[model samples]
Target: MSLSDAAELLDVHKSTALRILQTLEAARFVRKTGAGTYVFGSGLIELSELTLGSMDLRQHAGGLLRDLQRRTGHTVHLAQLIGDEIIYVDKVDSPAFQAVQLPSRVGHAVSIYASAVGKVILAYLPRQERDRLLSHVVFERYTPTTFADRDSLEVELAGIRQRGWAVDNGEHDSYVMCVAVPVRDSRGQTVAAISVTAIEVVATLAKLEENLPLLFATARDVSAEMGHSA
Candidate 1:
């Protein structure tokens, strides 16, 4: 698709799309052909391989997520922020017959302003960096609950930071709800987020509040296992 088409499809402006395309092209993740149409570039394959090789946390997270799934009986996800998106590195689904399946894959990217895991990380970022990142975002409304205004989103992010957790109440997808906690490094820098997602019917506010401690404890354990102190 042309830049204009892509921008419209993504609910973003043409200039924003052009800037993203240019950055991806400069990083060799995208290529503009003679017709001015962009395509995935060969360099992305190399970068993908390099990233896979360096993903030690993903390796460990798989097992940890499995344990969390067993303990909580909810879908557990481990994700890291990449640019303005969150990439799910690992996930484990509950065996419960009625459990909802989350559409998460190892390299799949999700909107930072939409998902609970993404919001947790975004909330902890420096204000200047957060504003810069949000300025480039289009704030697409995926559902009725999605935060589409910058001022409202900023206020919500402030709450996430103060609470040290994030909740997605059918924001990204109308039928899904998620609760996320940050995983910090040794220096207390937020590196990623771990979340439990389920169908809205099953992931009610009361249920999420009941499970909050378990989610926080698991995140702390994962952080410590990754060589983060405290």
Candidate 2:
């Protein structure tokens, strides 16, 4: 729609419509045509697809995630690589950790290089896609353990690829620890990750690693539900 049409439909001033269109265009949610009209952009389409796809993934993985949380008595998170960010698509809070709840929630974004879920998903992405995502990030050393630079993060990512999992040893928050494994789709693409997290007081990183076998099994089961084979 043109700015005039949009303003008419929205019952707003043309200046307001132009401002709205400009903001949307910046986010790539709308594109300004050469003719000075507006249309839905690829970003909007991609976000719509991510929403629908993540909904399906959440539904398919819900029970399994809850079961894993129950067995481990720790928080479980399912995060997906959505566009340029890694977003938590689902979470199962541990009943045992009511006193000190982890900060993660569904629909929240995680640091792409600092969190275990983020690293596992990034490690499995194609090199070009990985580079594209990292190119925009301004790394921060959230803790002494964070991979705050590209070179160090690359080494961590390489280890994750070799071992097929990632660990956050309080990288983002000194008290929080996590272990994550990749969740693959039908085409063997790593589209998401499953993580079990806890505070150091509840479970150290080593304690969390003890649950790796179960975590890996849960990831495989969820991946299978996503139509992955072998």
Candidate 3:
């Protein structure tokens, strides 16, 4: 708000409001806009996130992941881009398909170029950061569908950025298929990805694509939980 507006709201003298706002602006608790209005600043957001420390994204997204699993009847995975690797932080299996186990598990690292979740996160990252992450990777043709070279992987990543989502197409394992969407943080960085996975016999890639709307919705909800405004 403007200085006058703030003074009226706080029931203080305009000078008092200006002094208070100046202090907050110095600490970055609030920032003044070009239009002369005050808004919450990055420092305030950082402090809030730090306060919520241990109750991280995994905990915030757990209920949404379970709900997505129930709706899709497929295995759901949440993966985060930690340093140079994409690590599986959480997994939810469909209640009805509990006996049909796949190879994925929480705390496991997934192939960055061969997995849908990994690609989706990579696709939305800044070019320098993405290149840094991929620099250490040695591409391998895990399956016929895998983008086994940096050139081909770049093309696939480009497509994902254009489409706002990604597909595994049995890339890592010929029997497994997945579709993924990016999850953003409050600053609009794609910090994580959420994917739906299923064995070929259970659901083909085409079948999983049918649930893309649900997957995207779940991602948006999870991003909101992560403090993203949109």
Candidate 4:
């Protein structure tokens, strides 16, 4: 909505609305579109991490995560965005791929530019938001495959959007491969993600490809249970 419209709706002056919007923009609570329009910020979804909504989301998603873990025998993770970072809220570990999974606690923050789940969430966000996030990220290469610059990362994100999934390919480490897909909300907005990780030695890109349908199907099921019809 336009600033003037928002001002009228809130019964505030245009200047006051603009100032409030600017503050929310700084905090990533709202994002502007077009010349003066605004929409709920994708980062608001990030803030959902600490809310009862996130707990409910985890509960709704747990069974699907477990089933995916059992069917693939690969570690599964449920992650939500927090600004430019992603946090693991729940996981189901595969005994066979125990070493393949990274040592992550329930709230361990992961890089949005280097991890599978992070990239998938970023890749599906509005372009302006993705650009805004890219501006703030310092591309510290974690491994040989890590994106060294914004240009490369942008290209990869575009490819990920088209492919409907993302891969870590050892960008965060040299031994693990992670595959992730988006979890949409009622509005078809990707508010979270699910990922499967395995040792590169045991599972190649082709093997990860084979699991894509399973992973995506599980993500869909979770989204559905969260009241998303999409």
Candidate 5:
């Protein structure tokens, strides 16, 4: 639909719609055709590929995650941010007796307000975009530890951005602890996240802190492999 039509549907002024359309066009999210009508652009298609190419990333990161797991003896996961959620693309299970068994199937979705991997991507998103998403979604509580309030969640996301990582302290699932670092593209924009999840009994905060450097290093390596850089 045209911007004016969209604006009317949303009950906004026409100029507001025009500005929104212009912004999206500038961001390459929309294309103006010969008749000045806008439609989803090639950039949106490329971004969709970047987001949904979990199989491709899994194939590429499989060996890497395995190697990392072998080196650290901890479970590793690769996930992509989709809207307000994270979808697990691949994982490497630990050989340890008490390792956490994550039910991360090929297309299972996880919440950005709860999961470490999801939070990492959300924290790096542009502030306006992040606020818009948060405004649209109800922050459902998945566990006792989940962040249920927008203000508190905003504070937490800010900290995650500053630290360059995110942690889930039994937020989405009880007895599970996770740490995640952002994976970026060549533009230095966060495109995905790499995480390690373990049973709380085996993965204490101290252990997670100790492994933080390695996790960040591995994420950087994977991002570089995907043509992403700092």
Candidate 6:
């Protein structure tokens, strides 16, 4: 709709309509095509992925996640970001950590500010929506490494995008660290993410770095299975 059309429909001023359109554009709900024209965005592809559901996607990525977990001897997570929360849809526990594995389960909730998986999700969101969501979050400290505010996280998210992955650095648990990469859909939109976490004693930052290539390879394989293209 044109700015005037939107103003007329909502009975608001033209500038107010423009601001509304700007927010929508930032959230990827709509894209301005011209001076006043707009159209849908690739984020719409997210709806199709959700409608297809998690069961089938789990089946597609389960074997790959298991393989990655075994190779690194760490917990592997497959999660989707729904709004401000990361929903754990699948997990592969490493046999080596059976005695002290993380107590994560399918459908567990994690905050976007305190997890490798969560940071990857936040890093890939449409900027306006990401900032909007960040504004509402209560920055409670889960660990000394946890982000104390949005500015700290904004810096972290920028690094994540630069490297195509994120690291928790014991932000969620004082003795645990996780490395994660985003999973994109066919339209090149990130719809989910996968990560591997391990106890700091055995899997420190160096270990996570060593496993980064493998972790990203596994993510690419899963994305390919989901019909995602470059």
Candidate achieving the largest lDDT: 2
lDDT digits (tens) for residues 1-230 of candidate 1: 78988798889999999999998898788999899889999877976764663287777666777888888888888888655557887778766545456667767887789889888988998888788778778878889889888888888899998988998888888887889999876678787899988886766755865778889988988888777888
Each candidate structure's count of clashing pairs: 0, 0, 0, 0, 1, 0
By lDDT, rank the candidates, best first: 2, 3, 4, 6, 1, 5
lDDT of each: 0.81, 0.94, 0.89, 0.85, 0.80, 0.83
lDDT of 5 at 68: 76
Q: Model 4: C-alpha RMSD to truth?
A: 7.9
Off by over 4 Å in 1: 1-54, 98-100
Q: Which candidate model has the greater lDDT, 1 or 5? A: 1
After TM-score superposition, what is the CA distance of residue 137 in candidate 3 from its true location, in Å? Answer: 0.6
Over 4 Å off in model 2, which ranges? 3-28, 32-36
- Model 6, 158-197: lDDT tens digits are 9999989998888878888888999987777787899888
Q: What is the lDDT of residue 207 in candidate 3?
A: 96
- CA lDDT, candidate 5, residue 181: 90
Residue 131 deviation, candidate 4, in Å?
2.3
Candidate 4, 1-230: lDDT as tens digits: 89988899999999999999999998888998877689899768767754666688889998889999899988888898655567888988778845445665677777788888899999999999888877878788888899878899989999999989999888978787889999988889887999988787878767977899999899989989877896
Which pairs of residues clash in candidate 4, taking residues 3 or more apart in a chain or in different chains?
Answer: none
Which candidate ranks first by TM-score, i.e. highest? 2
- Which stretch of 10 consecutive residues in model 5 shows the poorest summed lDDT? 97-106
| Model 2, span 1-230: residue lDDT tens | 88999999999999999999998898899998899899998888889998898999999999999999999999999999887899999998887657887889899999999999999999999999999999999999999999999999999999999999999999999999999999999999999999999999989999999999999999999999999998
lDDT of 3: 0.89
User: Candidate 6: TM-score?
Assistant: 0.76
